[model samples]
Target chain A: MTTPPPHRPVPQPTQRVVVTSPRTRAPRARRPYSGTREINEQSELGAVYMRTLIRAQRRLGLSVCLVTTGVLALLPLLFSLEPALGRFRVFGLGLPWFLLCVATFPMLLLAGWFYVRQAERSEREFAELVERP
Target chain B: MTSGYAVVAVLVVVLGTILVGAYGLRVSRTTSDFYVASRTVSPWWNASAIGGEYLSAASFVGIAGLIFAYGPDMLWFPVGYTAGYLVLLTMVAAPLRRSGAYTLPDFAEARFRSRAVRGVASVLALAIGWLYLLPQLEGAGLTLNTVTGAPDWVGALIVMVVVTVNVMSGGMRSITFVQAFQYWLKLTAITVPIVFLVVVWQVHGAESLTAPEYPAFRQDTEVTFNNDTMIHAERSLAIRGTGEVDGVRVDGGFVLTDGYHRIGQGSEFTFPKDATVPHLSTMAHNTNESWALPESSGADFPLYGAYSLIIATFLGTMGLPHVIVRFYTNPNGTAARRTTLILLGLLSVFYLMPPVYGALGRLYTPELLMTGQTDAVVLVLPARVVDGIGGELLGALVAGGAFAAFLSTSSGLVVSLAGVLSQDVLRLGGVRGFRISAVLAGVVPLAMTFVSTGMPVADMVGLAFAVAASSLCPLLMLGIWSSRTTTVGAIAGMLAGGVPALTAGLVTMFTDTGDAWYEVLLSRPAAWTVPLGFTVMYVVSLLTQRHVPPGVQRTMVKLHAPENLGLDGSGPGSGDERS
Candidate 1:
């Protein structure tokens, strides 16, 4: 995010007074011992490193959530449009029953397993990048 | 079923929960803290604890009841409930724990740095917890009413007193192991009976569930209608009864016509073996063929109903007050994530048992449809299908398990709600604050059950999820992922989404406007309200961009970064290089 130059505070006549400038801009990127020091003190460079980690993790979470929920959401419409599909037997049980009751659990577990693996991997990669000598 | 065994079972479950809470209370945190937040209990044990706390009255009895009354379409309930944890695992599990706030309100205040947002979050937390607790109390009443032929309020009072005493006494101090013990107790109570019941079903020739014939009583049966009920008979039938039908007293034989008939309160009917059963008017009159198939939920918009239920449940689990507290038992972010995944497996195995009871209830307990006590299917089915003393023992086992579900879930809800209530509302700090809040929490919902119209227990639980999905879900999702959310936007988004959903849920519960076109919309508002909350929060935050929290960067670091990194905006940086 681009930090704005400081501005004078002005009280609004209609509402409560609001601050014009951010007090949270990490005291101008002080020179520090390491990246850890930079982050601990909240420098611009430290914000960059933190943003990278957040972006990677968010993308992983969004993709997994969307794909799994998106695919499952189509089941009700499928059963409605093609009535015969719901009736088709799978292993001697109705397909809708088989899919919704039996098959969905393992699929959810598999998706969760995939998410954990990827999330930890990215966290590891970020640590290695930050902790370099 | 004999009342003796069932009565004994209920007493044992009550005593068992009390004993377990007392046992947990006696052990101080240092020794018992092994499995609590201090890295003593491993992730799997924590998962079981969550499972214990979560496999509430809804999963145990309500799912099976709804499925029995409707059809296979109700399978979505179990599916959605499990998938909620999956969503929690993928999205909120790690980051939430890393945020270092034990409750949802804490997350709001920490993120927004505004008391206004925290106040709004606290209100919603209390509202959602109370709404969720309402059904657990109702389910307890229903179970007791069925088992001992006691009044509906007696069982509810027992649960309220027992749980209130437990929490007030601080017996749930080390709740992790106690909750885990509850999970195993509920699992066994539900599982062992299924094996025996299924074996009995197979021995009875595994009769086809999808057969075209209407369900017929296997032997001569006598039915008593304790409350006034309108029933629908598919064909003309002769019935023997003593009570009012069509406002005419028939002390002897009467012919039930091919259409609707009102069986007056306290009426008893005796039917010959192989007589066709007439189901209650509230039920969708379905033959075996239609009921076993999907999309036969008998509602006008079955598709919309299913989708709404899915949306509410899949996103709502993270917003629950009690569920959020369990995350703290884990030592760090990764442990929390692992705990959630193990919970998914635990929940999946428990969920599988409910639908089994539902399917079998359609066969052995078709009379439940006639009596409009379909929610009792789980408790009554064991005795109906299996014969002799074995059935009595198994029925007693199911009764005890149902009590376990009610006690575990409601107590968890009360304790967490009391936590929020004391800190936010009562402003009390010590044990005395918690005690007052706990009593108030139990008292408000128990009073509610006395006046409630008593809808099916599962559907009541779903409305609680709807409220969470509409209000708190947005706050958690937006507050975590988007740093630009401002104080004004947080308040506006919660009210905009929460009011409409909460109002709709309340409207559905207290009043019934028969077959209104908007009935589905009113009953299941999550399909629209969830997106409404998310959009309002995002758009408002964008408009009020200048009002973003000052310390958002530090807050983000605290939430998203691993704890071991020491980037928590504290003084770890100064000593880090030397160490």
Candidate 2:
């Protein structure tokens, strides 16, 4: 059993090594380290992340809004196209009255509920991705 | 109706609001609390407060009045008002909360990084606040005049004083509790009467509710004109009346021939039970037989007016200074979003009751149509239907609710307006500055109400929405989403959009040009002005790309990033990222 000389360079397995300046070190691979601050400090990464989040959020918002808007916009047209529908009554109330006055609100609430759920989910996913270890 | 009960009810509401304000004052010790309730309001409380403030005199009484007078087409007002939150929930709520800006002007300065843009935004906010406040004051005057026989100015003055004092004393912190309590108070005031009214309708056979033709007086009715009124007659009819008819001094019975007939002030007219109600010239389209018909009343281009109203209300809520400022009270972006979701529910439940009052008013208070005082239907219907002490109590409840609507909304507006005025215009940032701003914010609108007469409360509110939709809506939508939007583009867009809208609103307010095109375009400017605003913003931003704010990327990151991601997302400039 012989001890190796302290000055003698030990032969180690060849490993991949890329030269990098200490001033611009590779990003840390940890959950808290790679959160929004790191992403923000890295301007290019922040821009990409922000753009993607915005695009996703915008798409979700527009789709929900489109459906709601279409329904609202079509209401008058529907009544005009079929005047009888406006005259149609349910439970002693005029159809138009029932729809616009009573039914419209619940529909709005449902749409709002859907939007909140989807938006929160999107944010959650984005957070998870950014905070991945 | 007994005036005593109504007077008592109004006094109670005024006192309640003051008490709530004082309670809030006890807790609000810092400038932050004064502006954003120290950014600690929970979602439920904030949502309730928003509901209290957002349901103004327009929602409390005007929608029902419009529906009773104009029929089904007016239902769009409530629908548009409530659905506006959906737009806010999806696009602006979370990001706006994340911006950490207390007022619309704060947001403008932060996003554009330009004091010039902030100045423009502050001016627009003040204008919109004043425009919105005008209707609440007028509606208060109208409600008081109807209930207690007080001159219109008394009610306006009462509301103005109460709201100004509340804001001046405690600011947003105190108003938050006052508004939240008012929301529930308004709901109860509106809902309880509605239930009884519905039962009354059912007992009365609901026959008038389903009237296919023009509404008729169910019994011999005598209507006294408090003010001179011009009514449109569909066909010739003879009426027993006194005072000037169509400018002729009639001592006895007179025949009101076809076309327009003017009824002099203090004139009394008796109509037979089955005679068709003469439509007020102000409510032109309502003369048609079918109640279910979707015709626009008094609007030159009916379709355009309707669509413009829808667009204005749907987009305008996000831009409202008071409503937007409430979002900043939420603890975080998620809470803001949650608050919006809750607001939709609370507002929907509250809105469902107004139309019932309208339908019932058409049955019991048809005389309102002739007097051009349809707005009085809510205050008058309970007594008209229910008799004795019960009726008086119900009427008082409604009066209280009406006052609550006026107080909560005006207080919120004054607070937001004062915040912007002090922060941006006066460059003062203390309780004293806020008080001074409060007086300025409230008094101008109060003065305007005196000069402006006969404008429907709902219609006046619609004008404010048009201005907001044209100006601030474009700013918020572009500022949050488009990183390329420059300060020059923002200022240019706001001025180009807001000035024209404001001019149109003022013209519509002061003049009644019965011409179709002018009425349609000027009365509902949002359809054009909003698009113009967005286009100008986009084009100008493209042309002035070099002037895009330097911190835009960082701001975008702050706005879009999740709060739990451990980033400094709640500020204007992003902090350094050092691990």
Candidate 3:
């Protein structure tokens, strides 16, 4: 409208204003993926929580393993001595009854429960770790 | 009276299993399906299939036979076999499922990136498969010859044909269904007859048990050597008299006499000279005997041996070519874990039954131990205690179940071998190459069966475990847990561990050392070989750690991370996901 020259206001190359001064450069160098690296580092905080969970799970498993081994060692002796035990029954059962019922079946169930729960927990923790912000 | 019924039954079970397996084949379009049914199998189904495959001919006939011949000590086989699964569940099952490999050879290649290691694994898998297959074929021959008087070769041929048909048609998917169904059949066959036989025994009571003679003069149970010679060992038994041993009567038995007490279904016995030797040539007792208390040595050995054997079996289960392939059928690692747990349950329950059989054998078939028919113990049980129709029906059911066991396990092993073979060797060509490779894989074993002499099936299975424990077990455990494992270490460990286990097992098969120390070493090689494998892997890994590959850290993260985390995700303290 005012008959400006061909390019009209070729804006002065905006004063080359720089946030970082030449004399005092930034303390941290710019990483290739600054955003992603920051996010990953932040998410690592969750690792401690996950580690605790995993440690507890492993402790639980080791405890059970030791107990089960002890029980298995004792079973053969007890079952062998059943005839000499004088009609003794743990709960309304004979020597065979105690072995099959109280000992074998129950122990198997408990072990199975432990495995299922631990597997699930481990998987859940893994998923949580992956999905973290 | 109908001779053709047994043959027909064999055909129906074989064909039916194949047809069902074919139905499963429709869903198998990818490599995953061919190798592991895409990993979606539920635990119940997987457990059943595992049960089906786990119960080999040895479990069916040999176990009962052993129980019949020996006393309760023979129960160790089943107990150890099942307990191995528990060890697997706790230690290696989930980790192996996460390995994402198709076969043991595949795992070897991935862990060490060494063709040499893989070659060793492939050869071992093939050898063990073939060695195990021999007993199965022999069992089929024995069953056919014993039950229907068919030629032994015919029985072997029939099994080979049926197994080939099922395996070739469906691969892993098809076999999965076949094995699951077979497990149920096996359970029913065993349990139903036992119930009926017990009822018959209780009803018939003590009368049918004929007392031969009190304190029949002591007899030595002797084993034949090369059919031309004999070996004798002194044995003492509390003579229950010449009672009905498997529906047969003895001449004298209130007391033990120096002779083979119980012969065949229609046979008699007389005291023979050289009482230190088992039944003399003319006398019928060709089996051995010992005081019952002395024989139940399941507790006698050091616990270390027991624990080591259990660990070997448990760790070895994950490495078994046939068993590991089953996990490939599952949809994810979670399902694989569940499947393992279900397997544990099935194994535990089924295993309980074996000890009962062994205990019962102490009362019935002590001679089985002497004759080394421990594998046939399960098959002969019903007939011995139950009479007439019930026993026949039970026997038939057990036959079907035993056939299932042999077929499922053999097919699984063959498929694993074939998978590795086709991938590595046959890949040079195409589909035609694959077919040829399959045939070659099977034919070698079939030939080997003809050449192999007889051995106990349980012992053969145990040797397989020992081999697996020494080689594949260490590779897997270290590959999953240790960061420094190098290709060289793996190869060295595999060779060092594998050679000893195989050598000892084979030696035990061909030679019988009179010395107890020599006998124990030949029978149990795991005690030495497992540690040797671990040591080799660790030493080699440490030496090679400086040249660790770039992807190791990432792979470690993936391996150690939780399931929900995408494998691509960065671990804690990892600055960049890509790095």
Candidate 4:
């Protein structure tokens, strides 16, 4: 036994039908660019993305190599030009011994660390650019 | 020294390697597993393996001996070796890893799409690998002979057997674990002995290593010339010994002249305390002050030689087939860079110990300078500095470590060389083929050691580096970084740089070229060869610009892109096939 619903007056709603076609731009979904596909297909657009990444990495690598190894390559000339540097005491050891044996290791590690960080960052940026919506 | 303890130590290293490798064998069932552990290695694991393999006999024994004989200038060897990883990290490590290469030749083919380029790379890789192996074999013989009085061939034989047994049982997957374990063993073997030696040094009244006076016999010393030695004694001295000098036996007191005297094999000489030490004729820095200085030792064109050594080691590291193959074992490009960075740290720590041993040897083991067996300075220093049982125990630890170095390096080279031989040469693609190739790889180098004239271990290694830097370094540098490289340029560059450098290195190693003005140029060829390789590659590629591979755009993208960017494996731009 259900009770009868309360009676209420209802007003008619205003409505209009607008004509539209399937070819309307508003109905079509925009597709995100897949740089990955272009690169895979070896398209011109894909080549641009690849070039950007390769260029950035090559520049970082070249500069780092120059800064670290380029300077080191000059050391033999320095030692030759200033013979006294071979015997000058540093930390109770000859300068050459201290520099080559003790100092050079840490310096190499630091340079490597810097290069790795830069390379990772560049690769990350590349991934982001290619994958971005 | 103490052959009993040393023998025990050597046995432990050998047996331990075999057991560990057996464990690796269980996981290795496929061809990929045999070649590169299926590329699943983490940074820390691969880093340790790289360190174990990279610090060959050159770093373990050769660098210390060179430092002892040639003085501080020789410290450049350790420095250049460590710096090489830095060069690798900045330039080649990640790109090479992302290229999906199994070996250096695989990389060449992928880049150039030409069989001819791969052929040249494989040949150069084999040449460099064999050249590098010669020193390790030589050093093994030297170490065994120094500690155990074993025939020189005995140690090389032992190393070959142990490594082959291990590889036969497991392949690279087992070798990786064996090598990683060896790195720590080696570090401890060198480090622990040095700590006690330093304490002993301080307790013995802390003699100055850089003193102005020449090294003298601190106590009455009995010196044995294991190899034929030429020595320079500055003053007449009384000596009592049983041995041959100038091929004639002398068993009693004799007045040694002020000039050079040649001592034959099995010769023994006992020099009194405070007697001026007869110096090795080839190495002439007798005064501690001079020995402590750089560029004072008698290598001709010292500046050019040092610079050439620098170029060869720093650039050559990436091109080493064994070292290159190890990078391919990294799971991806990111891990490859991470591995190299960690490797730099591991190598730096180990390198510090060898130089310390060298410096201490100057004060304690000057007799090594008299005998040309300075390569054994690291093995001898621990026992000489510490006394009694403790010294003997330390000596054993070092001996064990030395064997570990030879085994790890040999295994790495054998794995890579076998990979090339079985896959490229024999066209055999299975675990059985790789196993057969492994044995073949070891035999060639072992046989070559019999014929090649032996140089000091570090010097031979330097020649290998020069060859590698001249040839493969150019190909990797150009191919990975530039898409313009053509097949003709690649082949041309490898031969131009490699052939002349190889000829020079062979000439230096096999033929005697004494005191000629041009001898230094031939002996230390990297100063010329590296530039030639890079220049020829660049210029020829530019000239043959239209001959570049049509698929190069895809290859370049594949090489330079991050793995997760979906550029992994054969096809790029495919839906995520991350497996």
Clashing pairs in 2: none
For candidate 3, chain B by itself scores a TM value of 0.81
* Second chain alone, TM-score for each candidate: 0.97, 0.95, 0.81, 0.97
Candidate 2, B55: how far from true, in Å? 0.3
Clashing pairs in 1: B34-B40, B34-B41, B35-B41
CAPRI quality level assigned to candidate 1 from its DockQ score: incorrect
Sort by DockQ, top down from the best: 1, 4, 2, 3
In what order do the candidates fall by lDDT, top score first? Answer: 4, 2, 1, 3
Determine which window of 10 residues in candidate 1 chain B has minimal summed lDDT.
B28-37
lDDT of each: 0.82, 0.83, 0.58, 0.84
Superposing all C-alpha atoms, what RMSD in Å does each candidate have to the true structure?
7.7, 10.5, 12.9, 12.2
Q: Which docking class does model 4 fall in?
A: incorrect
Better of 3 and 4 by DockQ: 4
DockQ of 2: 0.18
i-RMSD of model 4 (Å, 1 decimal): 18.9
Per-residue lDDT of model 3, residues B1-579, tens digit only: 123444555666677777787787686554434556545567788878877887777666665554444333455455556656665666556555555566777766655556777888787776666656667777877676645766567767777777776666666777777889888887776677677765665676632221321112223332221122221234543333232443345455533444344433223233333333242232123222221222324323533444545545545666677777776555455666677777767766655555445545433443444334455556555555555766666666666666766777777666776776776655523333444566766777677666555666666676778888888888877776665787777778877887888898778765665446556665677878888988987897788776454455445444444333333224344443323
Error of 3 at B228 (Å): 6.3
TM-score of chain A of 2: 0.70
DockQ of each: 0.22, 0.18, 0.08, 0.22
| lDDT for A112 (candidate 1) | 90
